[model samples]
Target: MSTHLLSRHSHRPRASLSLLTRGAAITPAITLERGRAHEACGPARRSFALWLAASTQGPVLWITPQWQPVTLNPDGMMDFADPARFLFVAAPRREDQLWAIEEALRSGAAPLVVADLEEPPAMTPVRRLHLAAEQGGSLGVAPLALLLTPGSGGAAGIESRWHMSPAHQGRQRIWQLDRLRARTQPPACWRLQQKAPRSGLQLCPAPQADLPSEGPHLRATQQ
Candidate 1:
């Protein structure tokens, strides 16, 4: 057999267990339910996306819209993931992103895929992505579709949906997580923070949730 043929046929098998949500409060059991699209929404969308991806094996395919104000920073990614394990595809058109994301999911080439769509995509594209994620499931990976949409509202046909935004106290890097929709559970919220790679996401206790919510955390931190 030719090396090319072998390479094409190869698959890196992994366990198909429920994924860790890395949430707090009622979200401790909130999961990256296998074979489904789980939407994440809010201003700190990237953090929500990376937090989920950090829990999976990588060489993750991160697809984002070209016009997004935020771009991937290698130094910043280090706090949550391996900079090298990520392969990014910046699509200039939302249409192109739809095709690329579905292809990546259907190919079963990567253990996880994150797509930061440019807008709230219609049901057709999201449904297709959900189906592709399901096909990838048979190959071994739980294959989560983590979409970073714009606000508290979520996409249709998603297995689960979450919302998160940066939370602050002076310069502390904390985030608030909310599981807005899920098949197995109702909405829940949590306070979260980054942890060592092997430790993944950790829950920040309630005693600390009393941070100032007077202004947007992003605006405060950028000053």
Candidate 2:
């Protein structure tokens, strides 16, 4: 067989997954590269992870500390992703939780693996996850591992870092999404809104500060 024909017949996995599609000419869709580890922080990090899972087709492996009292509410997940599609792995220790995440990515058994950690992990483990994901790609599908950290996540050596927080109004479903850091993109913020339950997500640039260019310069006189 010719080299060209052989290449054409080969299976090619998607390089990235899109979370939010482009809105008009504002910006291109939000995407996370496959076979890499990314970070999501802030108050709505879990929701952010769900958005990513919604865009992919496969079982989702969610790892959280078994001791943590908080649990995912299926009723609340309906709007984002089907709860049935998730497989929960509760690790009793922090180290165990990360270990599970690394193994899951290396196996390529699930396209998405989420690790809910109380604190950000150091660069060492993050690098391991990245390598694991890369190895998994060769096995079959390239898994995307998401690290959910509290507050402003500071996970090192990640492909990207995203922060999301609720910014809702009376009845409007709104959230502020910020791309804090990325390997190839600059920092940017956006207002994400879901007009209706099934309407889908919409994005708009975050509103600029309303303050004047120069705050009234106060003149002080000797008293």
Candidate 3:
């Protein structure tokens, strides 16, 4: 059998196991009493933490030019309103910051870590981050989807890269998300409409129905 097929098959059983584990983690009574109902839905119904927080749950460890860690969340919130859940550490330069990031990835406490520096990361660094995430069971969001702003370098180690430009439609802000690179998928774009107050985001006009049966693939990829 092909590698992809093997991966798909292996993923099926693991998905079910993952659901059971996550469900058990969330609620023990539900897993025991309503286990049949849970099993009936299969593994598809479990809420994946990474899936739940896509773009929103960033205790984003962003590396600055000075190598300082400037953490930012999805809503552009930064630094300690809540100290226990979020942390922002500053380093002096890119190299130092990357080292700190690797350490954090190894720690696995932070859900998402982002590096924003001037130079593109070496493949080794990228691979290291990937390994750390896989080992630690966390997700890594890299050079893509991160607003590099003025001094950001070219893409490296990123599975997908996006360039976002903000435009206005009347009073609303329409952010265009353009894909720079996406492996194993076609380059695609979307216009995100941001709602106020809670700042909830949704894809405008809905995505193409023919794409995939899974919930928004892009969101999954980003997480």
Best by TM-score: 2
Per-model TM against the reference:
0.77, 0.83, 0.55
Which residue pairs of candidate 1 clash?
none
Q: For candidate 3, what is the lDDT?
A: 0.38
- The lDDT-based order of candidates, best leading, equals 2, 1, 3
Tens-digit lDDT track of model 1 for 142-179: 57777777767558777778877767555556678777
Pairwise lDDT winner, candidates 1 and 2: 2
Off by over 4 Å in 1: 1-28, 195-199, 207-223
Question: Clashes per prediction?
Answer: 0, 0, 8
- Where model 3 places Cα greater than 4 Å from the true spot, the runs are 1-9, 12-60, 67-85, 138-153, 205-223
For model 3, which pairs clash?
Answer: 66-92, 66-93, 67-91, 67-92, 67-93, 68-90, 68-91, 69-90
lDDT of 3 by residue, 1-223 (tens): 6455433334321111121213223211111110000111111111121122233344534444453223233333211122234454656766787687676666655544544444556667766665555554434322111214222234455554444444446545344545445443455655555555334444555432221121211122121
lDDT string for model 2 (52-156, tens) is: 888888899999888776777776787787889999998989999999999999999999999989999999999999999998899676999999998899999
The reply for model 2, stretches above 4 Å from the true place, is: 1-14, 21-28, 205-223
